[model samples]
Target: MKRITVSLLLFLFLVTCSQSDIRHNQDLEDTTYSIVEDKNESVIRLSSLTTFDWEKAFLFSPYSPQEMIEEQLDVDFKDPSDLDMRDDIYLLVFLNKGKVVQYAEIERQDADFSIEGNLTPSNDGINIERY
Candidate 1:
């Protein structure tokens, strides 16, 4: 009986933990933002940024030129089926010399404001996308 109870408890714990999807976006305060990709061309320098909380890019950024960074992040959410289901993702990105370029949320169902602090700041030219 003791062993059976213990197994049941362990199984319940794992099942509960794995089903979470960061829905209703109460995890914004626990966000993990990172600065990714910076580069210098003889003609122009470029940089990018993105955010991640518990799931989804919130802001999925790909390395692009400094000028085109904003243009690129026009995230193509083909089917935002879960838009109203729960947590909306938010992301902020900047370019060279602390240039604020993009700051927006995706699929969030709450009115949570972004937490402005450096979870990770760029030193040289780094491109980070959360895993």
Candidate 2:
């Protein structure tokens, strides 16, 4: 009787541990995002920004450029007509709660490029930085 009880407790502990690990993995997968180069155009495509719960959070709350790239925008750069298309070009894009878009070009080194910043909304709009 004692051995049987011990074995049952051990099994339960293992099951609990495995369940926790699975939940952790699911959360990691939900938050993962990526950027891929568009082969047809001279542009990069940002992907996986529309996962369910995170999208709702992004649409309602103030987030960073990194968070936006990892959670919200789903734009494709088909025509580089208005863009400078240089390797050194950096852009700050603002998207309002209404989904309106605005942008500004900044002179910065290509090596200094990153997709991280706090993108709080103001009277102007929801602001984000892009490299």
Provide the overall lDDT of each model, using Cα atoms, as 2-decimal numbers: 0.31, 0.32
Across residues 1-131, which tens digit of lDDT does each residue of candidate 2 receive? Answer: 99999999998887555333211123222222122121222222122222222111122222224433424444321112133334343444434343323333333322233332334431112222334
TM-score of each: 0.20, 0.27
Task: List the RMSD of every prediction in angstroms.
Answer: 15.2, 15.8
Residue clash pairs of candidate 1: 24-87, 36-126, 36-127, 36-128, 37-126, 37-127, 88-107, 88-108
State the lDDT at 65 in candidate 2: 41
Q: Model 1: per-residue lDDT, tens digit, 1-131?
A: 99999999998876555333223232322232211112221111112222432111223322223334334434221212222233444333332223222233332222232322232333212222222
Candidate 2 lDDT (Cα, 0 to 1): 0.32
Task: Find the candidate with the highest lDDT and give its number.
Answer: 2
Candidate 1 lDDT: 0.31
